[model samples]
Target: MTPTLGFFAWIIIGGLAGWIASKIKGTDAQQGLLANIIVGIIGGFLGGWILSLIGFDVAGGGLIFSLVTCVIGAVILLTILQAIRSKK
Candidate 1:
């Protein structure tokens, strides 16, 4: 089934995913709402791409799966970001 999402849907997904990412990466207080949204959106793209590459299709739900996938990706991204930042 094809999923139909609206602007608010995206916001919800981004917020939840980003929050989860921040909590996982121990950066919840450091990153604000806007930053979370941005990271979450980017993480969504990254997650979807990675899933597709592995032959996994994730485009059915409204913001459930999307949020979960994005959170996972965001966590990974944040981890990488932290690692990189630590080196500098």
Candidate 2:
């Protein structure tokens, strides 16, 4: 499964997760496809890290879990960015 879920899978999952997150965060209008993909991948990493800190087993989680993690992280990331931008 690991081998099958390669770079392309990451991109697909990230893109979808990011798109959903952007919509959820109400920032979809401000982002492009590339941005979504980037955010999603980064968000996935961030989410995994955060969940791991709280003793969540993120690694063994399946596709849906991974997508949820990515979406959660993307929303958090977007919220932080929005807050920072608003302060400016």
Candidate 3:
């Protein structure tokens, strides 16, 4: 099993990743700090799972890799959400 990141690590990394993802997706203006953090945390989980499924080792990849993973996941998540919302 991959070792889990600590609480503060999650917050910091998640916030950064989420903020970046939102900016990339053009949704930054619609989200606040708390929302970014939450997106980041969830995006980390989603990213990790997707990477694992693709046979990538997500553990011990260090901070930069983790952030990249989270950003990719968050972008994907935001894309999906945007699509769904647009369809409504």
Candidate 4:
């Protein structure tokens, strides 16, 4: 996908993934929609990179794979964020 298209796609995936992560982490009440989207998108990129590092390809397989990977990343990110916040 082109950069612009990929960005938009990530935003959508991130938003949904972030929402899911928030629910799973029990932090939904503390985050807004935009924050969730941003976190999810960044988390998706991070997750994809980590997966790639482990020799797991995240490309292709349509939106399902995208969403799954993004969600996984968002959950990780959210968990870390919660931990950091707790420390503060």
Candidate 5:
């Protein structure tokens, strides 16, 4: 079965996750609302992909699951961004 989330649920979780990740990476000052949402949703996708690659079952989960997964991905994303910026 496909993992599905309601629109509002997705937005809420994504925003929260993104905000938290930004806080962790010290980039909260650089992100706006829409950017947070976009980063969050994409982070979710990235998290899912990473989990799948690691042979973890990432389906049929709840908010905490999604939050943890997205946070991990967002951390990775922010780390990559910082690395690229430092190289520039």
Candidate 6:
């Protein structure tokens, strides 16, 4: 069976995923480590969800796949956030 990830592991993954997403979204300058972690975790979830809806399984794709899905999700999140901010 695959080993379960610990809390720190999740944080690390989340931070990296978030940072990459922020950079892609052009919001890196406005965010920090904490924000990255938050975005990453949430993005991972959203990414996995979206991918699953599209008949993809990012969760089973390993590290690189995980990053890709997370990045996709983070970008989507940032896009929505930017749109909302623009409207306000």
lDDT of 3: 0.89
Candidate 6: count the clashes: 0
- Candidates, ranked, TM-score: 3, 2, 5, 6, 1, 4
Q: Model 6 scores what on Cα lDDT?
A: 0.82
Strongest candidate by TM-score = 3
Worst 10 residues of 3 by lDDT: 1-10
Ten-residue region with minimum lDDT total, candidate 1: 1-10
Judged by lDDT, which candidate is best?
3
Assess candidate 6 and give its TM-score to the true structure. 0.89
Clash pairs, model 6 backbone: none
lDDT tens digits by residue: candidate 6, 16-79: 9999999988999999999998898788788888888888856567877777777788889889
Model 4 RMSD vs true structure: 2.3
- lDDT per residue (tens digit) for residues 1-88 in model 3: 1437888999999899999999999999999999898898888889988998998889978888899988988898999899999999
RMSD values, in order shown: 2.5, 2.6, 1.3, 2.3, 1.7, 2.8
Comparing candidate 2 with candidate 3, which one achieves the higher lDDT? 3
Give lDDT tens digits, candidate 1, residues 1-88.
1224577877778788888899988999999999898888778878877776787767764467777778877887898899999999
Runs off by more than 4 Å, candidate 1: 1-4
Q: Candidate 6: which stretches are off by over 4 Å?
A: 1-4
Task: Please give the distance, in angstroms, between residue 21's alpha carbon in candidate 5 and its true position after superposition.
Answer: 0.4
Per-prediction TM-score: 0.87, 0.92, 0.94, 0.86, 0.90, 0.89
Per-residue lDDT tens digits for candidate 5, residues 1-88, read 1248888978987888889999999999999888777788888888888987988777866778888888887878888888999999
Better of 4 and 5 by lDDT: 5
**Model 4 compared with the native: what TM-score?**
0.86
Candidate 1 displacement at residue 61 in angstroms: 4.7
lDDT of each: 0.79, 0.86, 0.89, 0.79, 0.82, 0.82
Local distance difference test, candidate 4? 0.79
